[model samples]
Every structure is written in C-alpha cells, then in structure tokens.
Target: MKEARPWLRPDRAASGGDIWKKMKTGAGGACGEDEMSGEKTILVAGTWDTKDDELSYLSDVIRGQGGQVLSMDVSVLGDPKLPTDVSKHEVAEAAGSSIQAAIDSGDENTAMQIMGAGSARLALDLWREGRIHGVIVLGGTMGTDLALDLCGALPLGVPKYVVSTVAFSPLLPPDRIPADVQMILWAGGLYGLNDICKASLSQAAGAVLGASRAVEAPTFMRPMIGMTSFGKTVLRYMVTLKPELERRGFDVAVFHATGMGGRAFESLAGDGAFAAVMDFAPQEVGNHLFGGLSAGEGRMTHAGRAGIPQMIAPGCYDLVDFVGWQGVPAPLRGRECHAHNRLLTSAMLAAEERRAVARSICEKLAGAAAPVAFFLPTAGCNEWDRAGGELHDAAGLSAFCEEMRSRSPVNVDVLELPCHINDVAFTDAVLARFDRWVAEGVISH
Candidate 1:
C-alpha cells in the first residue's frame, strides 16, 4: 500500500481543512458574518481534484482577510478531497455536456476545452447574478488556459488574478489576455505547497480581495463615445473633440491606438458598451495587415457588428509601427523611420503600401450595420506628415487619399476635407457630420 500525502488526506488539519470549516461555521473571527454582510466573494477556480490542497490554502487566506471564497472545481477525471461550491459535474453540464462524456473523449485537451467553456459560462453567470465579486484561478498551463477564458468572460473593472507556473511566459499571447488581468508566477508550486508557494498563494489572495474592495466599476450614466487616437504629438483631434463631445451630453473614452489599448477598445465596443465610435486612429488595421505591431484581428469591425455608428478616419495611415527593440523589419528597412522610444519605432510606408492600407480601412468599414462616415484629410493624416514635418510625403499622402476615395463602399459617406488632420477645420468637419447625424436620428443622444 502506498502512503498517503499529508495534504491529500481528508482529515489533515494542516491542509487548511480546519480553517475552511471555521470559515463556514462562523467559528473564526467574522468569517461567516462578513460573508453574509456582502463581503467580496472571489471565485477560487482550478482543477480542484488535483490541486485541492493549494486551492484550499488560497481560500483559507481569503477568509482570514474577511473575504469569502466560492471554490469551483474544473477537474475532469478525479474527485476533490472536499466538495467545491461549483463541482466538476456542474461545470461539464454547464457546457451542455456531462463529466462522463468529457472523460469518454479520452483526450486531455478536448476534456479541458469542455471544462473551459463551462467555466467561462459559469463565471459570467455568477458575475451577472451578483454571486462573485472577483476571481482568482490556479493552474499550470491547463488552468491558465481556463483562467484566460474565465477572466475574459467577466467585464472590465472586475478583479481577475491568475497564479500559474507559466505566468508572463511567451506561451501566453497578448491578444488572449484581458486588458486588466493580474498574473503571479507560481514559483515552486507545480505539484504541492511549500513556504515559497504559500507566499505566492497568500499574496495573490490578499491582492484579489483588495482589488475587489477597491475597484469602482463603470457606471455608464452618460452616453459614451469611444474614440481612438495616438498621443497628442501625432493625433491632436481627440484633445479638441473629447470636451466638445462631452458638452453635447456624451462621455468620450479616448483609446490609445497602440496595440493593447486598441484591443481593450474593441472588446468593449464588441460588447455594445459604446453608443457610437470615433475610430480616427485606425493605424492598427495597417499594422495587422502588414505584420507590424498589431492589435490582433478584427480591429475596426466591432462597433459595426454591434450596430454602433462609426466616424472613421485615416490618421497615421502613412506609417507602420513596429517594436523598436526588434530593429526595423527587412521589408521596411531604409524607409523614413522615427524611433519614438526604446519600445516603439515608426517607418513611413511607400506610396503603394499607403494605398493598400487605405483599401484595408475601406474593407473593414464596408460592413457597418449602422451609418458609417469616413473623414479624409487630404493635406495630411497625421501631424508628423505635415508639410514641414519629418515624415512629409506629398505623393504617398495623395496615393492614400485617392485610394480611399475610389475604394470607399457605397454605404459609407466620405467627407474629403482639404486640411491637415490636426487642423481645427478637420475637427469641425467631424463635429458637423456628428451633429447632422444626431439631428437625423442616425445617432441617439
């Protein structure tokens, strides 16, 4: 007979069972009472069958900090030493499958995918029902995979923490990561607990609980206008447009047109979080099309899919931004380049590449369910490409503008303004169209 691991034994007091029971029964200081008084309820999620000891420790720490835990077991094959608030059977069934079906599949990846779908659904349901305030998931690679899904299911401003052996590893792609997720490396915590692992688990528990308490979720009191722009140095329209739009009874959210910022904007827009969009800084479309610093796929399509009216522009269409540290890409070498910082570099596109970017932008806007308007500033699209600016290119700018005019979909209303993108005249043109749209009920206040 093999000897049982100390933490694996059901009756082991040192494995946090005693603390869990105390928390449940109100025997510990303010644990059960705090839970009833609406203390933060964090969904402690992981393969509870294999990581029960570690998950319990995390729950214990949360309870000790006057927080409540809703443990969710996502294991496929084995039973947890203790019952979880959300069992593996419940998880499997949530995805319209059974635990038996998952096991019968006999492939670990397939089994985990079923669990991942179920876990994401349950997490969203729990959030909607006001049962969970935040979530912290534990895993190696498998748990991390489910963690991303679970976190992605919840809206922004909810506390999401992932403690994984591969936290911050290249295995995790930026597009899959939610904008506000917190990750801690599970050092020395692959199989079981020790002092180092406990240090990580305890800190993660406190951090999630603290975040849940401190976070102020979005109120959505005023109608929101989602706008995209780079910094004031390159794109100055937002500086004038945001306040002006707010004066017209709308809140403006300006998303930086860098990679991750555009991802967050798209995610929110896809969820119908915006009343309308000013997608002026759409350089990410070109970035994705040309294999530069990308904001992943589906860049300029989310608002349209959600039936949100869009005011599009070709700001910064003449430049392709790549990671500065990686050196200039071979295809773009010897182009007029600007090193913005240690982390970002921009290369001016050739006339044909600018034309290609223009076509890509038109293609994305062609499918808008609601009204679509494209603003083309013929003098220049970005401040850096103005007449005396470093990136000035008359022929390239002409190519882009001509392509936009020729390729724009019939559904799109193209406004060709004969001013630089930074000019007050350009801003006035956008506002004029926006005001007309509001009057015509194309956009509701």
Candidate 2:
C-alpha cells in the first residue's frame, strides 16, 4: 500500500486545541476563537493570491443575506486576515503542512490526493466544532479538484457548492457533487469579486442557512432490506416487494443490478449496512459465468457470510448483456442476439453457460442460513425469456436447474415458480414466501 498522507495520519501530526484556537493564540492572532452558533456558518476556501478580490465581495454579499461567512485562504502566500472576514491565519496554519506535503511529493496526483485529504480533515473538524454547516469553494482546475474532495467529505445532506471556471466541462465530468449538493459553473477565471461571485456566494449562504434550519428527523428506523434490480427487474420489485416490505415496516434500499451496483450492495451488506439481502438480479455473476461483458469481481457472492437474511433470485439470468452488435466479441459475433436499444444488446446463454451460472449461484447460496431461499421462475425470468422473444430457452433453463438441484447443498431451498418472473402471479408468490419468512421471524423484519 502507498504511504499514507500526513493529513490522513493526523494523530502523528499534532494534538492541541483546535487549529482555529491555536492560530488565534499563535504567530499572528489572526482570528478570534468565537464559535458560530444558531445561524449556519459558510466556510469559503480558496487561494487568496488568485481569489482575494472575489472572496472579499462574496463574503460581503453573504453577510448581507444574513449568513455568517468565514474565509480561509488555503494558500499561505499572504496574511490570511486581509481587509475583511475571519482568520486567514487559521486556515493557512491548518493547511500549510498539507500544501507542503503536496509540493514535496513530486507526483502531482499524489500531491492532490494529500491536499484533498487535508481539506476534508479541516471541514470535518470545523463541523465538529459547530462552526460549519456548508462550504463553498472557488477554484480553477486545481482548486476545483481540491474543493470537490472537501465537498464529498461533508455529510450527504450538507450544503456544498463549488464555482469553477472548468466546472462546465472537465470539473463536472461525471459529477463533482452528489445530486443533493449544488455546483455553479463560471466560464471565466476569478480575476476579481464580480456579480457572478456575489450571486454564487449569496445562493450558497442561503442554502446552508436553510439546510441548517431544517430538522433531520430519522426517516425510518426499521431494519434495512436490500434489493438488486435492473430497469426490467425493477418493475417487479417496485410494484410488489417495495410496497409489501414497506407494509411490514422494513426499510427498502434498492441497488441497480449493474456490476458496480451489485458490488456496492454486497459491500454494504458485509459492512452491517443491511438486515437482509433480497438480491433479485444476480446479473454480475451470470455475466462472469457466461463469459459476457458484465462480469463482477470474484467477491460477488459475499452476503451469506455477513449473516443477513438473504433471498437470491436469478433475474435476467437468461440473457447476457452486450454493448452494440459491433462491440460483441468476435467469438460471439454470430450468436442468437437481439437489439435491446441503440447502445445495448442481449444474447442467449448456452446450456453449458446457464449450468455454470446456476453452479456459481448455488455455491454462494449453499452456505446461507436456514432463512435463505433461492427462487427460480420455471416459465421465464425476463421479458425476453417469455412468450415471444429470442432469449426464451426453456430447455437450457431446465437443464441448468436440474444440474443445480443435483449439485447444490440441501441447506438452500430452491423454489420453482410456475409463473414467469415478470408475471403478477409470480410476484405474488414471491411476496407470500418472503412475507411468511419475515412473519415467522425466520428472517428479521
């Protein structure tokens, strides 16, 4: 493993009063030790040399909007306490070692990584001290990178805003902030405090203040029930399992059954994040078994050991996902396939491949406790596998099921539903079995 960053190993750094307090009493007495109370405090962090004029005007606009503003200059090129705002010294003092570590690392990536950790540490400490409810950062590319790191570190519901010159493209690539947070884009560099700066700052302040006032009552305290789904399989879960589970007072958290989606759900289950696993679509494992493109990592089936009430289903197990017709590997170039959409295609898994998938799934479920159940829809498991579609392989599915039943340990109960996976009757059967298990306390509600 790479050597941990200095800021990440803060126990080795120093232990005194908080960074702000130490900065107030040390070197320059730059900022007072007064804590922000009642109203939310917005921490605006940036390079003073580049953003001083912008920061000043933005701070004024925020205060005018009845929000407290605390400006911290991460770059220590000048006095942090300039003409306005809170202690610049405290910000520099806390971030100085981190900035120096980044410079000394020689590798720009490693440097940025350490700096990002430093910013997160600062935000966390401020939040603990009740001095920060939200954070707004202004930057160029480097600044945006550093600020986004801090934004992600804050709580999921906290107000985080970033104004960046590159935010329009590079900074906002996939998404720099979570869906709940706000990010503003500015095309030009921060030359001085202008109208855009004022607007962004004011909006950030109001957001943080509003967020501070909203009471975050616990949404639900019921034991969490995890479900894996795809666009097709999700309908069965949404229309049936979700309402039924909610009626039984179990909080449902659905994870899309894509590769990452399955991995994330498994990880959360392993981390004691859920009380039960209703993994309806084991597509990742199917892909891995079928030599398709959606294969999961080796650890796809880790939920059993986590001791959760696991109920597994092979939703979409009949079809293997592939990108466009041109993107399918040469060996499978002539296989039975269908164009599901412009960017995606589906293919039939061979009998041998289906048997392999069954074996892998059975291997995982074999070790599950008595409460565990594996349901196999004998008619069909997907829209393409029922009535009229290229992927309806009853012979292949039967052969696979027979092999699995013969090979699997008897501890796992395998139920064969006569209805197709998408049918309302099949969904009803699934709910009845699951609810009975939960009601009997075989699986925790």
Top candidate, metric lDDT: 1
Question: Superposing all C-alpha atoms, what RMSD in Å does each candidate have to the true structure?
Answer: 10.9, 9.2
Residue pairs in clash, model 1:
none
Candidate 1: tens digits of C-alpha lDDT, residues 1-445: 0111111122322211122232233321211233334688999999988999999999999999999999999999999998999999999999889899999999998889889888988887787667888999999999998888878877667799999999999899777788789999999999999999999999999999999888876555566789999998889999899999999988899998888889888877766667789999899988887778788878998788767889998889888899999998998898899998999999888999888998888888888778899989989998889999899999999998889889999989998899999999999999999899879867766
Can you tell me which runs of candidate 2 are displaced by over 4 Å?
1-38, 43-65, 70-100, 125-131, 136-155, 159-218, 232-234, 258-271, 284-307, 320-372, 395-413, 424-429, 432-445
Q: On a 0 to 100 scale, what is the lDDT of residue 289 in model 2?
A: 60
Q: Write model 2 residue lDDT over 40-93, tens digit each, in one string.
A: 677877776567777666566667777777776655334444643434344434
Local lDDT at 62 for model 1? 100
TM-score of each model, in listed order: 0.90, 0.66
lDDT of 2 at 222: 64
lDDT of 2: 0.63
* Clashes within 3 Å, all models in order: 0, 1
Clashes of 1: 0
Q: Whole-model lDDT, candidate 1?
A: 0.84
lDDT of 1 at 39: 80
| Candidate 1 minimal-lDDT segment of 10 residues | 1-10
